[model samples]
Target: MKRLFKSFLVCIFLVSISINFNPPSLAEPTSPYIRYWLICGPFKDADLNTECIKNEANLSPVAGQKVDGKRWRRFLSCEDKLTFEKDEVFGPYGNSVAYAYCEIYTPTARKVKLYLGSEDGLKVWLNGKNIFTNNAVRSFCFDEDKIDVQLKSGWNRLLIKVSNITKEWCLSARFIRRGDADIKDLTYRPAMLYQLPVKKVEVSSVQPTEPKNKGMYDALNAIDKDRSTRWSSEFSDPQWIILDLGKPKSVKKILLNWEAYAKNYTIEFSNDKKNWTPVYSTDIGDGGQDVINFRRPARVRYIKVTGTKRGMRFGYSLWEVQAFSLEDK
Candidate 1:
């Protein structure tokens, strides 16, 4: 009986050890991630900081080092940083809402190392532990080290310090999640909003013609004697050019150019010319020449071009206008 009791106790001990030895998987929760607005900074402007803190309710001061003459700081809470001048906001999942990935772009020639810091720009932290020290101007960049650890399924705050010693200060950051909602769905739909008719211009084709310029019609018929030097007729104004695409399709890019400078003009599209929606335009510049990249995902048959300020005549001069469908390979 003594031996049997001893064996039973040993078995119990072994079972207890086995239960404690293996740990549970950290990824048990499978709910979709939530989207959070990221905000940052007052730095030189205390008023901005106060407003951000009020709006976000997650403000925290980060400590940082001084590299060169400029002072730097890192904030864990999104409420303390400034919006990126360009490409500021992004998601982890390539514009989707699933995987969480964030990157920052900084303009500086020198190599930079980042760390998290505290108030008065003196403390630093990494992976929840303090590390490194320096005094330099902080610039923004895509630092893999700064984000590798803090990233999780839901909203995550990334704090980083940048050092710049090369050129003028310019910084930008972007964050995205993998499984987020498709931006294409939340796209701007003209039908939902009341909008005025916007003007645009389109050139069908431009070919080499006779030296005497009689506009687009003259150039199409003119023959080129010298193969090297071809007479090209350019169309200056269209008031607005309309194209019948025949069927609704996805447009990836649009290129517009005005031979001479034209005043206020806008680009619009529609299924029928009567009701139109503006897609691209220019305020004031050399002619109305521009390449517009739009994120609007929609189907339409007609594209209307219109002029806003009519006194100043502006028309598009095109060698050719081409529309392409986006493909995934």
Candidate 2:
């Protein structure tokens, strides 16, 4: 009995050490978070300071922390960006040496392009390793700095230092480009804020009202997980494609990959295959990959995209149709 007790104690001790020291990583893929936990200091060039830039633990974020002296919090630039005068809008920043750090949480390890815009000399670091540096004096433009970065599959650190001796002092950043271009295709939310798991859902059936060419382009091609194949509807006034997501699902987002034909369209959902409910609609849709976000979650099994206008004289064509559900994490 004494020997058995000693072995049990050793096993418990080993398990505790592993659990405390070896933190398991989240295997599921997650979007990059763009919200930032910011801390700034005013210094001068030629005599730069590296205290804040060296330690990342001081900058790591905690939920519901009040913003005050030495600690500030702000969300990244969404569709609109700030000019020189808007520097104070982001935080308590002034015309001098300032350092900004934005930490993003990703679920998968991959490479992404970090869109950043700033003035004067700037230095950047990712996960304690330097990735980008622009040593020049220039004006801040939208997407001024495009740096490719490899993000880990969990909590990642991003830090930036700027030396502004001329012009305005500001920064505009996004995971991708901003403005209407973003509206057309912005399905993934930045990983900075908390979000529920959302991905492409599987459909049980896909059908079109009228295919352009007889039996050539089927509606299933649009949902077959292939990009090259597409679904083309016959040349007519009203054409649409519908998908049944197996059973009733909680859907909150939709994507339209048009082939220069869909200039106007509407997204409708229904449960009993009748009494349809229109969730989102648009009149001017540029021919490209576009994303539509539903402010309210719709529970339905049937999802349809009805096109009213065409960019050209051709029929309404679609490269792909996607649906997703985003809930509180």
Instruction: Report lDDT per candidate.
Output: 0.34, 0.58
Q: In candidate 2, list every pair of residues with a backbone clash.
A: 32-191, 33-191, 33-192, 184-290, 184-291, 212-234
Task: Name the best candidate (by TM-score).
Answer: 2
What TM-score do all the candidates reach, one by one? 0.30, 0.38
Model 2: which ten-residue window has the lowest total lDDT?
A: 24-33
Shift in Å, residue 96, candidate 1: 27
Q: How does candidate 1 score on lDDT?
A: 0.34
What does candidate 2 score on TM? 0.38
Residue 62 in model 1: lDDT: 26
Residue-by-residue lDDT tens digits, candidate 2, 1-329: 99999999999999999888843221122223232335354543331233443463345543334333433333332223433334333333344556566666566676667787777667777777877778767876767777766777776777776766655766655664323133122233222332222233332223345555544467666776678877776666577777877666555567777774677887777777686777667788878888776443455678777888777787777777887653211
Highest lDDT model number: 2
